[model samples]
Target chain A: MTDKPRFKSARESGYLLCIDCEKLHPLSLEGELCDRCGARLHSRVPNSMNLSWASLIAAVILFLPANMLPIMTFKSFGQGEPSTILGGILHLLDQDMLLIGLVVLFASIVVPVLKIIAMTILLCTVQFRLQTNLRQKTLMFRIIEWIGRWSMLDIFVIGILVALVQLGNIAHIEGNDGATAFAVVVLLTMFSAIIFDTRLIWDNGVTDLPSDNSDEKDTP
Target chain B: MHGTPEQLIACHECDLLMTRVANKPNEDVICPRCHARIFYTSINSIERLLALSVAGLILFIPANIFPILSLQVFGQSQSEIILQSALSLFDGGLVLVALLILLFAIVVPLFQQVILFYISFTLHYRREGRLLRQAMHAYQHLRGWGMLEIFMLGVLISIIKLKDIADLHIGLGLYSLAALIVVTTLSSVFFNPHQIWHQIDLRRQKRATDDR
Candidate 1:
């Protein structure tokens, strides 16, 4: 409240104290907020880290089932039948799309699973109060979290096939239990990441510190 | 009526510093320096919002029931049921697509919508129930599973190619399924989860005071 600076709008009214000089500077209209003090006037989303982690966990869980279950049933000329996760990868191989097969295997199967495991470890470590490789874990988590949603390509393929391939009773497609489970797993992981509080990961270490006047004075 | 403190708030985009005050702006407030918007608690509604969400649940049944798509290749014609598609994919040895479709098209949507409705219903109508928070968390977890758009894309591609071969007929189920997608989207938009949580907190406080 001492030496409070005047501003145009309450929306714009906040103290922007520089970490280096410890002086208050008014926010600029050019960029986001004051660069020195990092005073933000507004926010984008709430608990983003929590949301990201929650989504990541849900994605990982879903990834497991997505690969384990049968995504779609293909009836071609009444001769085809349902395909499982590995079955589809093999089918791609059968279709001579080895590269696509591998890609699908890695993206839909490998990457997603790896991401889930990686995120789980990262989030769990932070959540459970065990922090060793915080930076590396966080970086890896970011990458996995970023690419997690794209793995839905396999699910998309199934949806496409189900929508198409309806040639009367001669050929048709259907979805099965496995597919539903897989989808749930994917969604669960996504939401897990979305709901998880990433900042909580950072908070476990500092929360136990003493809230004394000396500590408060040290910030200035 | 306690207000959130300044230190309690942070930038939504970058987690920078911000002062917390009661009744903050609802949307589109950016950080003056970083230009990052500082989003406080997201607008969330609880089981009460389920009243609005039931529409999505009702539409979901049709989304799954009717033929999502149909096609005719050459003189012969066929229809694809979601369940049958999974079976056929397994039979055809295209197991991956089969599994993928089941998960994205059927499982995820059903899970998300049902869970959401369940949570919202329990929270909104049944005031005395516990574990409402857990339900909200579960709903948030499952809501992303609905992969209607991705499924639609696959169907669209099939239609484009099938049209070259024979007459293509997309059924009422498919249209209803599409409408179901719209309904779910609208439900998410209209029902705010954070608001619901706030209401619950307020009620809890009021109840505690009354008990005291």
Candidate 2:
């Protein structure tokens, strides 16, 4: 295989590429709209870190009610019981549906917590301008982004159940407030990941920004 | 067409900018800094994309038409189709949630597949039209909203959740939905955005030269 050629960042090369039109423009036109596609041009997404942090914080706050409160209430013959997320998983386990239980546990509980934690570490490392594990961090961000949508699995399940099991008070299912909270948590985290610019993680690694060097040292 | 000051491209992952170079078919131009794939020249990409999308469209019919799951409790069995789940939710007064499921699970995915088929078919036959740009824009915007795979997983979880309460049977619609998910994902994997954009650019350039 032939060795790939080395590259400089658009920031370093004094140019910005329009993501929509793929047209190249000089960095001097950063604040101006793209001449070809009418997209606003920026060498990097402005305020990416701040937006990610805000959404991430909102997701973390909502994560509690998503797990603690009852996601749905099961009513059978005038008797009702509310089931939290963990309760539902354990109930499935109690009935010996191990595979489904494990799948729900992973998708609903494990994945969201892990995503939030992983994103936190990623955001912190990038915000602090740590130079270690740049490659691994980038890969982690990609995986997090790819798997983020699967967290919606629980919401879909609840939605399907609430619709399917209604038998007019014999065995009806009603969605509780927790379902809304859980959906919001999923959405906020997705927004957080979307707003995060993965390119910033590598910016401090290879490129030398003479102005930002002092700010980098200030944190460390 | 050989060497016109190779236009520069930026790496979406690591922000590395490099001059674009022509690649032989089946060659990938990977970013040097972060090892991310920048672009590639694939052989017969349009043909592969068209085939996969058409297959997905066929499967989508069975996915929505038949009952996804049936529940039997106390000698009364009721089967629920994909749309029924959303309609039932609406009856239960969860209007917004019902719309969300319908949009993500059914409408958006169908729209995405149709758009893919349209773009690939048009490009393969070299049809010139103004709708190509709008189609490409819609594809990019709606790509993230297609959640068939997530919905399928939800179906599985629901089956298991209802197992003890009622006798649950997976219907033909479930299998078709699964197949549709696989076909749509394969189509996306084969459909490279940069390559399609390059084709669009080439067509525009040809038209400009012809006009001149």
Candidate 3:
């Protein structure tokens, strides 16, 4: 954990590390191939911004229907009750299961929203080339990648309940449109995170500038 | 490492180029600019990874087959297995959601355990038959899709959600699934993907020299 000044980027030094295999290839080489693993090499992930932005935009559109529409319908004695994402959380809290309630609220609601917002901010930072708070933004991106999968919690819950709660007519659970939408939302966001190139954050509008950081001599 | 030229490593997060340092066991090299991990080391990596994957595979069947919980409602008790989670959803006509659940909760995790075991076993013995690179490549791709731990949490939350409505009893599958989650997470925490790549490269090098 030593903090030091930035140095020459591999992009500027004219080499690329294979994102798949970590094999380094000089950028000037024609037909760049990862000599170690043979994955086609790219200096930066090609079309990273476009791919991530496309995925993120789709996720943003899906997020609404995912939350608003009923995910599951619980029926007891022919009486049907449908619950949205927020509705389910409120139901859990109303049952006085404080810890479980908060966990659901966090997983089902908070995490997805946070992930969406964090990804947007990171994308904007890259698009606008905002160098301030780059480290924190990168850290946030890491956390986003790790936590993105957990947003599937709600879908899994619906799956389990839909499977388990079928007791003929007395009580049963049925999956709905929201579950599908939510599942797609989770997948899209995860893809956006995966498609995003973290290195793009550090380019910091300096891809064209020939001045590499000169503080390498004195800095630790 | 002995006869190779000095390697230059680039930070994946920030793209800063730095000369690679051979890491001691369990050492992690942190990127100076963005504090991302540049190097991750693991001791007995292949053996430990294989052990965990084998353990996960052993638990996989029972974890999916046995009832996660049995519910008692109006004196009629019924139990639900983990696979039913996906099967039931598909029956309900939420085909995509069902398939996603099937993929994330059951299929992908099982595939991961098998692929991991295959990759590690092949890498450990330096066995030749399968394409090691493609196998390792698939293993890396599978890592993102498997959500075993998240599924475990969903199990717990579902249990709590249904607790008030019915008398629910926890079952063998839940216990096994919990163990599976612990084993997989532990293996992931201290893994060295590069070590696997390096070993495969060594094997290639050895074969090349033998040809000469």
Candidate 4:
């Protein structure tokens, strides 16, 4: 019998202890390994980063059409109106919805492209182990991850328009080919941010987690 | 090192460092040595969102005031409403479009920015401090409402269709929107969630030591 470390041993019914660490919580967990760290208690998904990277690449390619093509179609009095990202903003200005126009232009156009570029840079640095501004690079990663979802604002609006403005022969709103690609761009970035770990930023060509005081050591 | 089919293995990251009696696949546990989270926890959430909120606030001014689009049809030209595009939709009897625009483009971003600023600064400056749980709850609620990109997509589609039927022209507002998007994206990417978590841990540790 092993005399494990003296942690509070639970004697409650239905409580099973982990033999290696000898800690107890609940039983019938999904895996054999600890879920937090890669201890061989159970098996789980591996190559998560690789899969995320592939998906991110696919999304990036699709981003071209998302930005370049017409996302929605307008039919009023039997005349067809098609607008790309730029045209929509201009149309808003023409209609005097100055603020809203600016918001759309910035959120949909500028943000997504910049995010792609930033992510590509971050991924490259991480993969190739480049000596660059680690702090600034990490900051850029955080920015991309947070704003990934809001880019779907246009898709959501289109969905609403298509759903709500179904007044046949008077006015109609329809989705276009670019919508699908746009959706992919949004979904990809969202997943890419979720899957990619920011901890890698602090890594200095080494696999282990950086020590907290390493920042002090790294500079001087 | 006794090997058994039911032998337990302990995880290094779990708070309750448990040993696995059975060799199960992908079964993660916490470590006894540290209160590190296990089983795929996001390193940072609030801090990342806060960065976006700040960017949104900064971009909000330009988004609201700039013109989104312009129209020239039949030698007579016009433009679309930005925030009030929804109002125009309503006037044109597209009530839902108007409401969606107002909610996502205007109201949501504004709410998220204000609340996020208050929470982060409060935590940062070491205020007498409201409950962390309460603050996190508000953040979660506010986070879901702001929908910037969706509104942008709508604007894009509108322009494309409008161009075919009418002569469309770009304006200063269009440029502003492009800038807003870039700022928001960068804000989200640059923020780190782990940093905030570290601050909280330091604070808690300090409290515990003071108690001792």
Candidate 5:
């Protein structure tokens, strides 16, 4: 690893790739629009960290009501019982639908909380420029981005149930306020992840550190 | 502009600039520093993309036209297609939520399929230039918005939730939706944007020489 030549980043080499057109342009055109497609050219996303932090904070605040309030209310013969996310999972478990229960548990509860935590860590690590575990951090960021969308599973379930189970006063299903909050939480976290630029994680890698003897010796 | 297309390959992840080396089909060119896949020579990619997109198009009709699932309680049954659900949500005063579902689950996926089909058709027929580039850009922009598979999983969970309260019956729409999800995913996997761009560049160069 020490003997290999260090790769120069586009930023270091004075070029920026247009995210829209994938065309490489000189860095002198940074604030100016892309000549090829007229899209804004930036070496990195502008205000990425600040925007990510704001969205993540909003998502964290919304997560409480999303899990606590009833997502769906079930009515049978004029008697109604509203089910929170945890209550719904426990109900499934009690009914011996272990597989479905676990799926809901993982998709609804575990995934969102884990996604929030992951985003917070990634944003903080990048903001503080912690050089340790940069590779692992990038991989974590990828995994979070990929799985963040799965949390929408619960919202979809609510939409379908609210539509299908409307039997008019006898055994009806109606979506409660929590469903909306849950949906917003999912969307906010996703936006936060997207707003974050994963390339920043590797900005302060070993190559950018103070010159060591190994690096000096490797340079011919 | 300064180098041949083969010499212009830059790793989007690590920004490592290197000349493109010849690789067999299905071989991936990975960035040495970041281990990100820079490009891959996908075998028979255009055909695979076209077939998958067509399959998704075929499945899209039944996925929307037929009832997704039917619920029966006390001998009274209610069924709805995906669109009706969104319409009902609109009626229920959840307009934003309704539109969100409609956009992500229905509209965006269909638009993505159409874009994929257009690009694959153009590529297979050896038509290149501005239209192909526009389609490629549209596909990239629309790629992140489609969530058909997530919607299907949500329907599955909904069915499970309804099982205890009523007689739940699966519909043709459900089956078509399952198939549609599979087809769309396969289409995205087989569609390589970099390869399509390379093809476009090659055609442009050829046309330039012919004109000269």
Candidate 6:
């Protein structure tokens, strides 16, 4: 005696809703503009996977240089040293600025890695149509989207440092290639997450009309 | 909850035909099929959003114009305001980084707050739905690009990193920058565009029924 309807989705009932305006139109009106808001109504975003894969692969490729090349160059008294992301963190740790060092470590290093890995897992789940953990996958996407932007912190810090630390023969900080690569990496990951429609993950599993949403089979 | 077919809302995350349900204040209505948060029923969404965005717009001015920090290196001292700090990168031959700073830290933040203020204010006074819709779209698209909070963290990290290299003094701009970051973040969390869209839906439906 469940109250839920047989049609699991508006798509199943041959309807597509405007995401912005929340107005439902028949699926046949796919290419037509939503009269209320003018957003082109589609049952689903076309080619969401292909674009997500492209952005993700590019981010993975750029992640190498983002970590390997020097992120910033600090020069003092005619001596210059270029430091990578990890090198900078080590330098801070060497100075016994443990708290700030950990902060940088989390934002610069951990967050990107976490975002890339999480995005990959999400893509695979949808790509293979893995029916399990559909809800968990959506939650993961939200977490990554919210935290993904914070990875820009390191580059902003470097920008300010490069701006403020110029002194002839005393101290100077220079911007480097790694900063650009890192910024690109962050941007690409953000693009990938945005392009991915989390709805696709449920298309494989949500067909069952009476499925309990809280399928805590994998909960700890 | 409205039972009209026009009231049917689809889940963007799962494509479920979610029934229209009354939203209790300070609660969330999530899609059952995918657990995507379909509605964040923030009470007084427009009023709260207006207050927060107004505070952010005010703070944005001083946060950009006032000197943020002054650094003493050997016998030389250089002071920087937020806007000039980003612009000065052009002189150092870091045009790309400079542009990034100007964009993510400067242009986007101002535009976002202004757009939010406009949308909330206009919607508050029952302005044209078409204009409010356009502003709403821009606000949504601009959400991901603004980085004032990240910029604040950068300011803190840069201050610490410079301690071993130079003497530093925090300025009014830094404090304003901190305050601006907080207000904008609160603006983002508390402002929900869904409420505006729902209001638009109500008007459209009422118009349809009245024409009958």
The best-first sequence of candidates by TM-score reads 3, 6, 5, 2, 1, 4
Expressed as tens digits, the lDDT of each residue in B102-144 for candidate 3 is 8888888888788788888888777883577887777777777
A1-27, model 3: which lDDT tens digit per residue?
Answer: 243343678777777777877766677
Candidate closest to the true structure, highest DockQ: 3
Give stretches of model 2 more than 4 Å off.
A1-7, A21-23, A31-38, A206-220, B1-4, B19-24
> Model 5 scores what on Cα lDDT?
0.78
Q: Mind giving the per-residue lDDT tens digits that candidate 1 earns over B109-179?
A: 77777766765666566556466555555655455556676556546545643455468788777787778
C-alpha-based local distance difference test score of model 3: 0.83
lDDT of each residue in B92-153, candidate 4, tens digit only? 55454456567766776676566666656656557644454344344444453456655666
lDDT top scorer? 3
Flag regions of model 3 displaced more than 4 Å.
A1-6, A29-31, A205-220, B1-5
What tens digits encode model 6's per-residue C-alpha lDDT throughout A9-128? 777767787766666788888888987677887788788899999999999999999999998888889898899999999989999999999999998889999999999998999888
Q: DockQ for all models, in order?
A: 0.09, 0.40, 0.56, 0.07, 0.42, 0.49
Q: Once superposed on the true structure, which residue ranges of model 5 sit more than 4 Å away at CA?
A: A1-4, A32-38, A208-220, B1-8, B127-131, B206-212
Question: How do all the candidates rank in terms of DockQ, highest first?
Answer: 3, 6, 5, 2, 1, 4
Evaluate residue B133 in candidate 1 and report its C-alpha lDDT on the 0 to 100 scale. Answer: 54
All candidates: CA RMSD (Å): 12.5, 5.8, 3.9, 14.0, 3.6, 4.0
Query: Tens digit of lDDT per residue, candidate 5, span B1-55?
Result: 3322424555665455555567688888765555677778888999999899999
TM-score of every model? 0.53, 0.89, 0.93, 0.45, 0.90, 0.91
Q: Best candidate per TM-score, number?
A: 3
**Candidate 3 vs 5: which has more DockQ:** 3
Q: Kindly list the per-residue Cα lDDT of model 2 for residues B1-212, writing each as its tens digit.
A: 12123456777777777767677777887765666777787778899989999998999999999888888898777787888767876776767667778888989999988999999999998888567767877887676678988888888888867877799888999999999988988887787878787788789889899999
- Which pairs clash in the backbone of model 2? none
The better-scoring model by lDDT among 1 and 3 is 3
In model 1, which regions exceed 4 Å deviation? A1-151, A159-220, B1-7, B11-17, B22-25, B29-48, B90-100, B122-126
> Which ranges of candidate 6 are over 4 A from the true structure?
A1-7, A209-220, B1-4, B201-212
